[model samples]
Target: MKCNKFLKGISLSVVWITLSICSVSANENAAEVWRFGLEEIEGSVQDIYAQAFKRKIEDKSQGEIVVEIYSYGMLGESEDLTNLTANGTLQLTHASVGILGAQIPEAQVFTIPYLFSNNDDHNQAVLANNPAIYEILGNALIDQDLRLMTLYLEGDMVWSTNKLIRKPSDFAQFKMRVMNSSLVIKTFELLGATAIPMPYSQVYGSLQAHIVNGQTNPIFSIEEMKFYEVTEYLIWAGQQKFTTSVLANQAWYLALPAPHKLILNETIEELTPYIFEQQIALNNTQLAAIKKSKPSMALIRLTKKEQALFKTISTPIRQQFIQNSGQPGQRLLEALDKALATEK
Candidate 1:
């Protein structure tokens, strides 16, 4: 009996040791693989953020966490990536507010044209200091099972067309490809273009086949998408600005070890400005490159008066957006206005 008791005690000790080892191994494995997705082409803003994220996470985690980036719709389209992240199929993703807004209506506030008079105002409204703004926007995302990691600027929207767009009248009858955002569609409609909502991947084919005569994007996207090849005109309208939100699957993020979660949040905080600066630098370079490569492409430079005229025409569209988006839209506009007022 004494011998059997001793043997049982030894067996229990061994089992406990094995279980502890298994727990440690599981945690180590969890820290090793961090997967992320982006819809942008490689080297674009999305790509830049993904690369920055990988570098920072790996450096901070000391190789304990490795980040894998999938770009150019590798895992799926923009909408698919958004849904996957929401459902925890993907760990992380970067999506334009326009796409994310479709899932969380409150996000539409970022899509409001001219709501931000310039880049400085937009940045001020969304940063960490603005708790009211962040709280509202962040909660909207949280409700959708996504955590808003960071808001990164994608620059102002500009026009690209096979025909010149020097004036509002120039866009008349032009079939312009726009994201499937109601505000975007309304904005283009106000500008006199036949706004055709399509995915970014479809823009190229539509332009190539003359199914769409024009599209709008920041200059970096024009270069990245090779819009110059399909279009003969580039316009610097700066009609609207856009920002992308880096999001993580809330469940997946919460599942991470405390240290790993801290590392991810810290890495994103460090990477936001870095990625935005890179985007600005790239946009400048792309603008120069596009000018050099397609010298014949007409460049439409709008005068202040003409831009004002365009804004005047877009007022009703803005009103419609606010009305359609309801109280959430009002709250966003109020927050933006408050941010802008502080600048003065």
Candidate 2:
């Protein structure tokens, strides 16, 4: 009889332990889940960052907050995702700062040609050392129902084309695909190229069909889009560098539990430096890989004189951005100038 009683006791203990584990899992399931939308394909830098963000946030929060990333237009295109994120319909998104200008015009400053001397200046201004620039930019977005997180370093924008483009005059009459930003369109127009505004999804097809003669994108994106498959040249004019950002729905972000908010802010702080460094390294790797794989794709490094000609032609467009960005823009520009000067 005592043996049977001992067996029953063991079974009861097992049931209690199983119930306790179930209860803990149920509590974890109850934690809030935020959906992060990204347009980059799997293995791209943007997608890599999204995965890192999700991992760090969930790990730090101990599952009290969950981040689920939907990539490769799984959510929508960049413009659509930005709008959804702005209205709280979507929780988060990653995009170039220029794309947010429609919601906050001051963001256009980042898209201006030759904005940063190189990646290090851009990194300091956006992430490491410049609080003045961040404050001005963050203030501009606070009222727009979006929150600016940090400026991500991608790479300098390079022009890829089928024709050799070593000088400013060579750009004349070339049809180039540009983003929806007016500043980008004007930049290409100033170069004497016809700027065709097209969604990123269509870039490959457009290039294949020769719908546009070429497009401008980061060297990484040029590889991601496989533009070299159809095109034969890469122009290193150093005219513009791309700066992406992490933008959240202000309403959703502000209402997050204080602890959860702290986790996210902390995650950004930890990840920014790593991302800045990784992107610079990745740009070099991807550029080399593309060139080795596709020997037909040639590179044109513009002479200082060639870059000078571009700067001279694009001066009016840059001035217009400053004049039109308002006082906030002026302040941000001055702050960026200070940052760049100090870094140099």
| Candidate number with greatest lDDT | 2
Candidate 1 per-residue lDDT over residues 1-344, each given as its tens digit: 11121122223443454355346546755467666888798988888879878888888888787787878656556776676566554689888888776656677777766666554535733554566557888777777788887786777688888887777888888999999887888888888889999989889889999999988888899998998889988787757776788888877888889999898878877776687678789899999999888888887877878778888888886577568767876777777768765543
lDDT of each: 0.76, 0.77
Instruction: Give the Cα-based TM-score of candidate 1 against the true structure.
Output: 0.87
Best by TM-score: 2
> Which residue pairs in candidate 1 collide?
none
| Candidate 2 lDDT (Cα, 0 to 1) | 0.77
User: Lowest summed-lDDT stretch of 10 residues in model 1?
Assistant: 1-10
Query: Which pairs of residues collide in model 2?
Result: none
Please identify model 1 stretches exceeding 4 Å from their true place: 1-31, 119-129, 342-344
Q: What is the lDDT of residue 204 in candidate 2?
A: 93
Span of ten consecutive residues with least summed lDDT in model 2: 1-10
